[model samples]
Target: DTAALMKTPLKKGDTWYLVDSRWFKQWKKYVGFDSWDKYQMGDQNVYPGPVDNSGLLKGGDSQSLKEHLIDELDYILVPTEGWNKLVSWYGLLENQEPIARKVPNAIEKEMRKLFSIPDEKEIRLWNKYMSNTFEPLNKPDSTIQDAGLYQGQVLVIEQKNEDGTWPRGPSTNKLTLTLQ
Candidate 1:
């Protein structure tokens, strides 16, 4: 249904569309759950691996256009430096920001149209789920693999330390994506 829906362009100003967020399941449990046993189911917290958007296993193949666009629009790509540029364009970057990430205004407009959020006050979305600090969503604290994001999901920036490096945590190099 998602693939069929995304195949065409949406022209209406504010229409709701399906967004994949199976990737953030563990992160949700990590931040929201009171105990490990509550969210754990076998190796559920562990990163199993990446799969195609249709829930099919895709050995070593690259992400399809649908998957890429879904990730790009959902802010699931936040861990990469590319995400910084998108965030900057969203005008969320603060003064003295470390990175200079920007894209052309025309492209930004088009992107907003495609991934239009239902709520302009997107900060509420993040606060509703996790604390203001990115510490709970930190790679070290969560340890889950990167995954697809749900609709209306806002990207949370992991604050860098005073030493000009990211906070100390286990390096989560795993990549796992799921869509539901």
Candidate 2:
């Protein structure tokens, strides 16, 4: 009977009384039904059943009952922060495993295509930008001296930030840059 009831197709607006024994007890306690007979009589005042759309569950018609059931199930009502944390935590764990183990080579190939590295010109431009923006905090053996020209566009390197990770003392003499 319970399985048949679950299989029953519920329309947009259909009134349903609490007949399930488990739900009946909960409903009786929730509404404070004094007598079991009164609760079973399908009384409107004590146990109202109205075909309404305002409070229906995802697949049922009755907001209050649906909410009660969801609460009873200890369902996790996820907020934006919870969802973000879940995604971030999953990402951290997922990165620990190699992709080749989880997906087929076809998927790996597609991912490789999607994240293909840029050409030499793009790298030069990026290097130039890095040099101009960051002031070298320390002197370095090597400097971004020049960016070659490509497609008639000249690439110029500029001083950016001093490499903070330099092994020696704070030289405040090195320059970093990138070309466009």
- Separately for all candidates shown, the number of backbone clashes (residues 3 or more apart, or on different chains) is 0, 24
Q: Which has the greatest lDDT?
A: 1
TM-scores of all predicted structures: 0.21, 0.15
lDDT of 2 by residue, 1-180 (tens): 232343443232332232223333433444445454443454444443221222223343332333333221323222233323333533312112211111112222223344563222111112222335433312121221111112222232222234533332233434443455
State the C-alpha lDDT per candidate: 0.31, 0.29
Per-residue error (Å), model 2, residue 4: 2.8
Clashes of 1: 0
What is the lDDT, from 0 to 100, of the residue 71 in candidate 1?
Answer: 38
